[model samples]
Target: MAEISREYMEQVAQMWNARGKGLITHMALEIENVSSEGVRVRMPFNPDFCVDKDQTLLHGGILTALLDSVFGLANFVTIKGISSMATLDLRVDYLRAARSRADVIVNAHCFRKTRHIAFNAGNIWFDGHEDAEIARGTASFALTRGDTSLLEAMTKGKAS
Candidate 1:
């Protein structure tokens, strides 16, 4: 299989960032890396997403969404064309609390891909601590070809 070019992958990352709005935009999510093998993303700490009144801990849902997005990005990069995909299942294990003011780093790998399903695993950690992880997750996505619903929205017009 042909690999995606670095320039093209960078474009993909920018497109993904542009298409991200609402909660993702509000959370300041950024794509740090994209490749056929995996993807990396960073989400800066936001007091609005804090779970505690003191803003010392982040809510678990934020990490789950970030993991799902990163895993899905890994699957998308492997596809040759623009296709529609949905998360079929996601399992996340929380190992520790995410401290406030620290960016959340998520790295995901596409371990396996079949005709219709893509399997991925990911790890989430606070910046500056590679050995210490805040959470880890696995996800499966159902991919569809020739589905331009997203392609059209992303390329031609706004996505609903």
Candidate 2:
């Protein structure tokens, strides 16, 4: 793969984070950085969050959303732009619970992607820069030949 410019990658990542273009808002899901290599995203514990009642700890489902979003974004970056790739499967194993008292970080990346499957890995961190490795897994995404609901969703999400 050709080297991608950092500026360009950031632009695309920002575009992906747009409220209209994505379900994961940048403010809600802080995608602090993104490159051809990986993406670093942060999500703070909000008592208002619909998932869990604990104000300090993040919900596993929220972590899963973070995982899914980062993985999908990373894979989209690997394509150098948007494509018809759709997540066929995603499996995550949660090791330790996130630190109850602080914000959490999700660092994710795609190793390589083929015509169909995209391999990815990442970890969750709490109250530190080092990955806590709270979870890690691979995703199988199939590249669609033409317009599918994924693309339509992307389009609609962006249009708003």
Clash pairs detected, candidate 2: 20-157
lDDT of 1 by residue, 1-160 (tens): 6767877766766776777668767868788887766788888888888888899798899889888888877776666554678999999999987875788899999898877888999999988898999999998988776656454567676642
Candidate 2 residue-wise lDDT, 1-160, digit = tens: 5888888677666666763233475327777888877998887666654344656555677777778878887876556434466678888887876546667778889887775677788777775746456666667676654344333446466321
Error of 1 at 160 (Å): 10
Clash counts for the predictions, in order: 0, 1
User: Best candidate, lDDT-wise?
Assistant: 1
Candidate 1 ranges with C-alpha deviation above 4 Å: 147-152, 158-160
The parts of candidate 2 lying over 4 Å away from their true place are: 20-23, 49-54, 129-131, 145-160
- Relative to the true structure, how large is the alpha-carbon lDDT of every model? 0.80, 0.68
